[model samples]
Target: MKKIQFNLTFFLVVTAAACSNRYQTNNHTAANKADTVQSKYINQPLVSHIYTADPSAHVFNNRIYIYPSHDTATGAPGNEQGDHFDMMDYHVFSMDGVGSKVTDHGVALSLKDIPWAGRQLWAPDAAYANGKYYLYFPAKNKQDIFQIGVAVSDKPEGPFKAAAEPIKNSFSMDPAVFADDDGSHYMYFGGISGGQLQRWDNNVYHADATNKYGEELAVLPRMARLGKDMLSFAEPVKEIKIVDKNGNLFKAKDNDKRFFEAAWVHKYKGRYYFSYSTGDTHNICYAIGDNPYGPFTYQGIILHPVEGWTNHHSIVQFKNKWYLFYHDVQLSGHTHLRNIKVTELTYNADGTIVPIKAMK
Candidate 1:
């Protein structure tokens, strides 16, 4: 009887050990599957041949399309003149498969169409709304006056045509358009000092300039509501201040304070995220705010001065994943050879963006 009992006890122990091993293996398999799912959702740009700068992208019909400031076949960058000074041009690139890789489709638009524009053209932003695609760009007049212009196309890849004359009397460049869920449209643009808020009117707004140059005299970081059509502002302009040079709360004439330019605002998970570059364009900085027109608080610098001198960025959500789109001087060098790069954006629990590391 004792020998029989020993044999049974040993068999039971062996069976329990085998079951434990099976459970451990299953757990590891599940963990690996989760990691794979997370990685697949994180979108990064695939390699491409074109060297472009100040890229603005919009995803539609399950494909991502990018438009950037023009670069000549000789690999020369455009917009040498002041903002709104150039005959605006842009190159079109598309991802092959959904999230596959970027390919240059060649020139989407050029200045020859707009005979009136001067020689300098700078940043460009594109968006799809109301069954049409719009490209917003800056161009100069014969008198060297800077203004924002719009081009519209039936499809994403476009021989876009100027919808109307340059929105006259607006100075700060880099025009970005955001259509809110409530059907209101807003256009944001500015540089160094701060950006402006204007209602989008197919025609232009005629307002007296508070400054000498006829530029809006208001401080940097401003916003205005747009009319239903997304062309003009709805209300008077309001200013947004994020941080000072000392990284404190913003105040007038704070030598250290920085305002918004290359500004983009998005609503995520019921919160508004406004991200803008600070310091100098060459040294891109960032900040965040709960409100669109913010009394925003400075989070920190996103991209510091590195191989390239300047950085201007945009953020987008594709396939439920967030990405940072910006230009870096990696291969192009000090010639400001800006090329578009896409990277994963991680977030903190406190609702701030994780700082980006400088490229090696």
Candidate 2:
């Protein structure tokens, strides 16, 4: 009886193993089919009609909301002249489901609405915190000096009011906001020579200006901690750099500066990923890193300029699936009137992101 029982248990175990293998194989097959369908859909030209660019998107309540720089006239090509900046506006779009094509909702915020907003209101990033939706955008004053401003509304589609005066002492727009699991908030902005992070303290900052550039300069991509009230920083600023440009690691060029702008940082599965646009903004490239303050190694190109000069991008994940949200100027003819586009992002075994083809 004991021998018979042992043989029976062994047979049951073998059957279970076989069944598990079959289940995994079937699961993989189904996933591959879904991917093929998605690839076909993404390959289609998404924003062939309108000229919109500098996209910032967030997933809220199972829907994705995108805010992009909008062209004033429908079917009108963007004006690239310095004076053309005044024609730009901020428009919001939403989809009922994640990864769905965004439908235009007219204008959410416009340059004419803000009392002090200059002719050009550039890249805008939005976040939902507490009970309010906050938008951080770059606009010029009557003097035409560019500055960052904040607006608040109760809903994503909002008649948002300017919450505070334009943030002083910062340049190189494209502002992004990140709230960590610990309830701390950080704002990342600036461009090639303008990136920096600040701690929030009730919609205000103490303004730390101790870097080599001095206090008045707004350095791009600098990381700092936020205080309890969510308006100011709690620590000294740490400058983040890419690995290819790092003197300690690669020794590429002391001043050969590879562009790193439009930074979006997220911590996932014990690794912090910092994605930024590299090279020229018109010929934008992409790289990733494990640390927020890098040594960020070049992964590969996410989207290359198809009909235009460069690509500005943002990455967000919803429901365990990752999507790359970005803007391109195919229709606007290399002007700043960039249209928003979306594509699914896949990862390699070593955690590198797969390069996506530019939509035709």
Candidate 3:
């Protein structure tokens, strides 16, 4: 009787394992199917079918394309550890020509295709330069520490191919790339708590050092000049430090602009606007400077927190109108999964953006 019981329990365990594998396979298959059916919607909260957030928008070849991260619960086997962001893929959305249909170019990149990535993807940015479209993303490695990677494609909406490895001197995440009018390329990146920053030195591909508070770098967001290849840094000393409203900058808990993450920089009417999600993670604030690298004075909030604890945005002027793309948690019923929202961002007479509430 004891032997019979042991064999029956063994059979049950094997069956459960097989069933679990089948479930995962089915879910992935369904996701693939959904990726192909690009739903059409014209409203706030751009995507509702699947949770999507962290929008990075740009005007490419007279059309607007958005690269956003996929939002999900910690994936597969289940998050027995509770809820956390679990983005394994990315999708690109575009409005081909001004009044044409909004196209969802599905699965621009996915972790299943990248061998080095530890199966986690985060906020990403894209740019068109030198006849190629580039996608910069921050993802974790097998060790669970996050680093940035770049992928390339001939088309704005891509079936992209990633480089063999990540960008050498990249650390943290939320990579925002900007191409200047003079054909120069720059990238803004980083995010951490208590104003501590981890960075890569020219001497070390991995960050062997930590930047402390009160330094020019700690309080400000960092931007590096990209090499012609767009994968390496060109100048070490020219890294940017974010400035504040009073010609000052953020510090480690010493100042009000304790910039948490989401570094977004855009130029408006010859003035560079440096915007970011402040620490409390609920506000998307801005500051204006004279150059791409800023000595900016704080302007004001472009987006205020609504229901979620984190906020991120991208600003773009499309078809002669400016729009702010950000995310919130109203649809998910919990903060772990989020949805993207869009609204018209208005500028004051003095060039500062009027504070706006996040919708949908």
TM-score for each model: 0.70, 0.70, 0.78
C-alpha lDDT (0 to 100) for residue 150 of candidate 3: 92
- For all candidates in order, the CA lDDT equals 0.60, 0.61, 0.75
Q: Global CA lDDT of candidate 3, please?
A: 0.75
Task: Summarize candidate 1's per-residue lDDT along 1-360 as a digit string, tens digits.
Answer: 999999999998998899899889989999998667435422322333645777676777888787777543443344422222222468877774445657776677777676557655677887777787877777665655556777878888887887456764455577777666766667777654222223222223334323212223224554566555544456665555665435455433332225535777766676766666542434455655555676666666655543454567777777887777776554444334456767767778876677766543
Looking at candidate 2, the ten consecutive residues that score lowest on lDDT are 248-257
Of candidates 3 and 2, the better by TM-score: 3
Badly placed stretches (over 4 Å) of model 1 are: 1-48, 72-88, 96-99, 193-219, 243-257, 279-283
Please give, for residues 9-28, the per-residue lDDT of candidate 2 as tens digits.
99999999999999999999
State model 2's lDDT: 0.61
| Per-residue lDDT value at 131 in model 2 | 80
Over the stretch 18-68, how does candidate 3's per-residue lDDT look in tens digits? 999999999999998755432322234666778888889999888889898
C-alpha RMSD for every candidate: 15.3, 17.9, 10.8
Candidate 1, poorest ten consecutive residues by summed lDDT:
193-202
